[model samples]
Target: MAGGRLSWAGLLKWSLSYVDGAGPSGAVSEEERRWLAEAVERHMMVDVVSRMREIALLMSTPPAVLEAQGITHDDIEDLLSELQVHVESIDMANDLHSVGGLVPVIKYLRNSNARIRAKAADVVTTVVQNNPTSQQLVMEASGFEPLLSNFRSDPDLTARIKALGALSSLIRNNKPGVSAFRLANGYTGLRDALNSESARFQRKALSLTHYLLSESHSDCSVFAQLGFPHLMMRLASSDDSGVREAALGGLLELARDTTLGNRSLLAEHDRLRRLLRGRMESIRTMTPEDLDAAREERQLVDSLWITCYHEPSMLRNEGLLVLPGEESFEQPPDVAGRFFEPMRRAAARRAPPVEGSDPGDGTGGGIVLLLGLAPDGRSNSPSH
Candidate 1:
């Protein structure tokens, strides 16, 4: 009975004696408890280290063996997700490389299960995000190829997006990673993503494109070679505002390129000017919430406009930047007036027809905010 029964007497005795004092009760003092906590924490961290290595070994195990052990994609995903959380700490991120977790995580980018592949990319993303040490290690492991593979052709949208995100982090500040991307035709893959139906997918690709272009001013011509100018224009007009902004940002970076090749491509030529002009004129219908959200979009549009047209935005033209009621440094009047106003007035004097608008509307190259012309147009432009 004692050996096999519930042992209720023993449990009662243990519970009653469990008080925090050095008495018959098996309770330790505060100092002893603190010491115990320190030891427990150290042991817990040790366990974490062991668990990380174990997960890494399990991930490196062949899929066939894992399947035989009844480990499914979901199981692998959960394991990776946990590893990813651990890898967010910079120490743990470096520790992951030390423990050989990073490579296997990269390897799983080619895992048969779509969700597992995506989660593996997620782990890679976490590992390499701002960690140059891990970033270099990842590139050395030839992690880039599988990531590129998933980003280019993974059937799962999430997998593609996550893989793109991982690749982005991998190459961020690593010049060799960037060179590898160029050699591996990462931009072409990004172009494919831009054409994807997923808005987030397109946005991530756009951001990465902008970064890559920013890193190498010469890449703008690569984009023009890829016909990305026209593609970017289409994306800039996307119904999704984020997609539109990302695309516009990419275009702005293209416009800033001073390379002879970019100049030959004529990114800042009439077509872009007309596109920006039409976009500037179209913002009249945005609700306040939309306008607030779209300020960055408008700013990108404004910058791209001025870059191509060599004049300030309509905001500057309207004296909003110059004649602000309060003295603020947000828009310095000297910078605004010296470079922008004279050109705007000079353009106004000529009063050219808007390139993309109806030829006979007589609205001029810029938006006309004439009273009683359109009820909503005038009010929407000046408030911000």
Candidate 2:
């Protein structure tokens, strides 16, 4: 081996010569061939490492330094685009956070360039998803307002979808973040997303709406006024199964609201009843795999049924039995049943008694009296 710099071209030439019988009238010795192969491998590794080092240095450069270099927004957009490729690496994500890479990334969310804004929103979503610390930092950097603004008014559908996605990740399981979002009229943005022509945006918006509604009764109350329940009921029947599932999830959360008014409002909607009955019929006919896939939808349909019918027996059937102490003080019993019982009794009275039975036997034909009962094991109705 020569003590000279080894170029890839030179290695190739040597290897080709060795194969062409330039050495020893046919072929190089085994030792010589091994040495050439090792040399080529080592040179390739060195070149790769050198290129990697350049990339590392470039990524580690601060945003301020890039700005000082007169880097255009397009250049920053390219850099962020590259950064997004490695965002799945936890180490790279944390490094980006620690080095303040996210600050400029967040700022780019408001950039005049729509592509830049869209890419920035995607980067923010990837960084903050399931990462609470990054979420808080984004919030501190005023990241949320831009996302909500984009969601509300961005002309580009893709950018608005990205913004909605980021907002969903930003507030997931973050209490204060959700509160801040609610304070920013975030529900209105979400409502618009729900109404978007893009089904992806509607699906993501429904998921976030479910989370926010589950977090507080006040959010449920506000969203209810925005017709969130009606939107969900419509979406629950979406042609896209994912959209239907997300919408059903939102309806389930709304159904769980302890507020009597909210429950009543949902239960009283004729559309909701039709939706529930249709879904229940479909669930009954589903195959086992389909049943598993639709387990959440089935649960929600059942919940809505119980809510609408005020059937504690149905709740018990579903293992959602409410214990005595666990019941809300403000929740009244099934007063709808009580309110309709008199009508039922009046109708029963108009019908003739069974031919072989006495009317005084406390029975109208085979119909049993639904009279209120006393704790002493006696009916409150007048004795026969």
The residue-by-residue lDDT of candidate 2 on 59-133, one tens digit each, is: 456667867888776776676776676565555555565555766677778777899899989888888888887
Tens digits of per-residue lDDT for model 1, 1-384: 223213443443444356433246554676765665565556556666777898989988998998999998888889988888777778888899788787788777787788988888888888899989989888888898999988898888999999999999999999999999999888899889888888899899999998988888878778888988888888888889888998888887877777645643544367766777677777756665666666777778777777766767885565333232434325545775677687677767876575677745645465444334346555434443
Off by over 4 Å in 1: 1-41, 261-270, 319-384
What is the model-wide C-alpha lDDT for candidate 1? 0.78
lDDT of each: 0.78, 0.74
The TM-score values for the models, in the order shown, are: 0.72, 0.61
Pairs of residues clashing in candidate 2: none
| Top-scoring candidate (TM-score) | 1
TM-score of 2: 0.61
Q: Which stretches of candidate 2 lie over 4 Å from their true place?
A: 1-78, 284-292, 311-384
Query: What lDDT is reached at residue 373 by model 1?
Result: 33
